[model samples]
Target: MRVGKASDTDVEQVGTMREGKLDQKHLLFGEDDSPNNYDLNMGLTGGGGWRTPRHRHNFDQIRYVIQGELPYTETEVLKEGWVGYFPESVHYGPQERAEGLRTMVLQCGGASGQGYLSVARREAVNAELNKVGEFKKGLYHYTDANGVAQTKDGSEAIFEHATGGALRFAAPRYTDVIAMDPDAYDWHKSQDTGVEEKWLGRFTERDLRIGFLRLDAGAVYQAGQFNSIEILFQTKGRVTAGGTEYGPETGYEFLANEGPVQVEAVEPTEFLRMVLHTF
Candidate 1:
């Protein structure tokens, strides 16, 4: 799995057309920009000549504008920190812009659909962190509504903005290990474990899926089978995702596609586990 911030790696120039003006840097996938796999492409558009003729793809895109506003036909403009999910291809992009555009896009494999963000509809929803309790030795929040309070160790739940943000809760000082198990079909309550657990909650309408995880000192979620793809974010602590181990600064990611794997917390690990649906 790849770890580290999306900007850490130099963008690879896969192909460029029209003299480096409107070229597509192959972000995630291989060189071809072909089909059948997850591909993330970063688009650097030169001011004035940036355009992606109305088209569509066969996957979903989670686009994050890193620099200049990317002009799109859907709403005309998408600013930084602006995330838009477009299913497959719904006829969008490069409407018109005065300056250039740069974006970090996350595309899912075998995905189809068109989704967009209404640039005109930007609202601030007040999100709060319910710090139910303190950590045993560090900064882990140990208060779970589902589990019994005051047990050896408890779990904490913090809510982040529906769209995008860093994290609502910080990792407690003693949170040394991390465990993530995403339930796709069934829901499980947090159990009383001596270790601290941090639950990253992402709310949706359809189904409720949680990255039910926990972390303890010197503990590694030694490669094992998880319910869903384990997307690990190393906020603080030495950890490994898949076969790749990263440090505190490296934002490595690993995907456990319905199998067993190991995620070891080498240091005082503190990260966020995004539970797809909760509430």
Candidate 2:
């Protein structure tokens, strides 16, 4: 089991691949050797906020709004406390996020086996690309081999630059992005006493899952006993595990069936749980 706290993580400005300003607190990073390596982070839109063109990725993402709403499209909005699932190769935004909007995001490899890119690698390429071209707004402006002026999506440009090849996207499996409201779902009792769950749904053959877990004060719950990587993010209250006390904003990780670790709730605690995609 791996545990980390948001307070221990430093807040950093977002990469220049996207438009505007945002700051993030990265909570957890998955095994780098694995194809499904991922990053879990929480970010807040700064002064001018942020925007993204109508774009898609080769990876999957799960986003939860903590404060303010997410303008997913020109017409659709995900209000505070809502969640969204962005499937690989699926397009959604042309978004214009308002200032002070805070969101928790998980980005990982999708079912298509196209491994996600690491931030470290991407940022390295960003610096290299900076010497050749300029990133303005959400686009990269450059002069290609033919000496012709070109403009491309900043993220796509970074990927191609890093790999020295054209960026490719998988054939989309899901027709559209999924938006969910957790409050509309009812919490059901889990097998463990004093523990309950509100499962949103599972996705793809990989069995990726999104859910909420609640543990009443003084209760001990066994966590991380799953066939795939399981992550639990403490959203409210406090808990103690392996003799360590963890408060809100703490994140825990367990490898496939690596645990049934004991976690005791010091206060009535709630957690956002994710079962990552299995290869």
Q: For candidate 1, lDDT tens digit of each residue in 9-98?
A: 564432221123553443234112223234445566664554343434333344546567765565655666344544433435434544
Number of colliding residue pairs in model 1: 29
By TM-score, the best candidate is 2
Cand. 2 Cα-lDDT: 0.89
True-vs-predicted CA distance for residue 22, candidate 2, Å = 0.4
Residue 193 shift from truth in candidate 2, angstroms = 0.8
Model 2, 155: alpha-carbon shift in Å?
Answer: 1.1
Consecutive 10-residue window with the lowest summed lDDT within model 1: 151-160
- How does residue 142 of candidate 1 score in lDDT? 41
